[model samples]
Target chain A: MITVINSILTILGIYFGIGLLFGIYFFLAGARKIDPIINDSKWTVRLLLVPGAVATWPFLISKLFKTEKQ
Target chain B: MGLDYQTILWNKHKKVYDKLILAFMLMYLLVFAGLTFTFNAQTTIETLIIRAFGTLAVIMLHIILAIGPISRLNTSFLPLLYNRRHLGVSMFLAAAVHGVFSMIQFHTLGNVNPVYSIFTSNLDYTSLTNFPFQVLGFVALIILFFMAATSHDFWLKNLSPSVWKKLHMMVYVAYALIILHVFLGAFQQETSPFTIGFLSIGFVTIVSLHLIAGFNEVKTDTKKSEKDESNWLYVCRTGEIEEDRAKIFTVDKERVAIFKYEGKLSAIHNVCKHQGGPLGEGKIVDGCITCPWHGYQYLPGNGQSPPPFTEKVATYELKLVKDKIYLNPEAFPEGTEVKPVNC
Candidate 1:
């Protein structure tokens, strides 16, 4: 049981680590494109949203690449 | 959209909504507690509190989720949409109470940290009957906490409406986690058919309401129209639009709302700048297009918020050919001053 719990914890840690990295990238690169309303926000406010950003990155990615109709 | 924020900018409507919510919560707790004490006097107080709050929170969440689709299907239900954030925050508080009492009751007095024991003490992941349901509840609680903490215009302004909206969409994820938590946890121990039936009904109701609302929207969007000379889409006869009301059109997959007010016609992007609400669905209030969702307003001519505010939306050029409204598919840059054509 101890070994199984440890393995689960290890997998969770790695998953969140990767999510955090993607969150950092989203904050730096894709936030403005996905949402122009954040243009005037402070860096600290942006940083606070990192966890949520990581969790919802798939939706952001779609918005980032969405082409506006002519 | 106010220049400054209060804890809550309470109005008569909000005050009444909040009072109703509180009354319902108190009544639910009272009845639940009374029934438990009468039927099973052996049950502890902590267990009673946990079950009562947990069930109430889930019930409130169902109501919150239902309000959106119900309002879409019938506009009279829009009153419920006004103070929905308050409902969300209240639900979170109830869930927090359930979580705290649960943690103290089950995981405390152990050799390890209560928070740490929550994850490590229940390691039966391979078995469906014992799959550490507490962890699922914990994850759902974390998501709810984030949502409730940021359920303010301050976060809306700082995080941007789109990102804030995306973040709040995690409610669906939390809902799924909670469903799993209840199904695998209490259902395993209780094995009562009534409880399982109730949960199944709630699940089906939410899913069906969403599907029905989505189908209605698709039907509206797919309505056919015509085109005119110079390739501009023919929206509708000017007479089709009522005074101070808008006729929404989908031009090349983008929604445009053409409003007729004060003997003039103007077209603007249908999505509101504040929360992507349907501008066309709203009526012209005080000579400005008011968003039905939150009362965000914009002048129809320039698609800009009236002076002292800076929000803007894209505008489209319109032509009047003998009372027929022809709209150019191209959108001008947001905040551009477009001349309104006299009807």
Candidate 2:
């Protein structure tokens, strides 16, 4: 369990670090002219989908995992 | 924009930005805390749900970080610079969560503790692909935490601006390390070629934008210095300054705005302390140099504030040599150190 977990974390650590670096460079490069038009556009909408999906994912996955009597 | 209109927009937009970050932080904590209680019932499906939320928080932080230098290089972006520490704190919280949750989900439940296993289980850290990437996250989080902790106006007021700025630059170094960490660990683990392409584009786009902006800021500073024209003595005759009026003179390549009013001559730095607006184009309002651009009022005699503000600009020593104005370019203490100049 520890090995699997450590392996997963190792991946995530890099994933997040890369995102941060990407964002930093993005900002620095566009500091002169970029207005972040796309980024600022209603991120809340994307965030809201999380709770909705969280509520539904378990329900959908549970049914598939259930055994049926023949 | 008019002062009142700018004021309204400034306040409204500031409120929206602040609330967005704060509300996001609150939601992250609430949902992540819920996961802790529901840990016993957790599954891969649940972990994926948390990951989705984590991704959302991370993107918002990127946006928040992007807003700073973007606004600094452009005056229009001043709204973002105003009280930006709140945004920093929010980013810290989001990054901290990313660190903690990954630790719990992947490492903590194992036979040995996650922290121990991370260093021990990981193969050759010396190798590029099999690096202990979580340590990078830990270090980055700590840097973010320090920045967030010092993100108050109190620190800005206490520490010199130069010192504060240098400390904040550490964020860039941390960010770079994080990117490398992810490139080696996360993308490697997922083994998704598509993710690699997407991450490369993201990195490229952001870096290019910043490089361009940084270069632009450097150019702006150079241009300002080169544009200055100065003369030994600019003879704008004795009555050049009328009561409540300002006259601009170039002395030793410095723009000196001399104001004459009520049989008195007052000379001050011709540039507004706020954003270096031209004070020569300004007016004397109630004994203060009222900047035309931003309306930042400065007293000509000593450059002190009317009250509740301490911003000041350079002042010059003036002398009427041969009935013509002979000015010394040496600047006196800005604001409230009144030295009499015989004019």
Best by DockQ: 1
lDDT of 2: 0.59
Residue B294 shift from truth in candidate 2, angstroms: 14
iRMSD for each candidate structure, in the order shown: 5.8, 15.6
lDDT value, residue B19 of candidate 2? 83
Q: What is candidate 2's lDDT per residue for A46-69, written digit by digit as tens? A: 232222222222322333244222
The alpha-carbon interface RMSD of model 1 comes to 5.8
Interface C-alpha root-mean-square deviation of candidate 2: 15.6
TM-score of 1: 0.83
Number of the top-ranking candidate, with TM-score as the measure: 1
Writing each residue's lDDT as its tens digit, candidate 2 over B1-343 gives 1211111123566678888777876776567556655864554654654454455544554565566557645757665655465576666766766677787777887798676665666656677676777667766776776566445332333333455567678888777776776666656577868546766776776677678788865664343221214433444566666667777765455667887766667778787655465677677787778886556788878876566666788777666655566565567767645554444
Docking class of 1: incorrect
Of all native A–B interface contacts, model 1 reproduces a fraction of 0.05
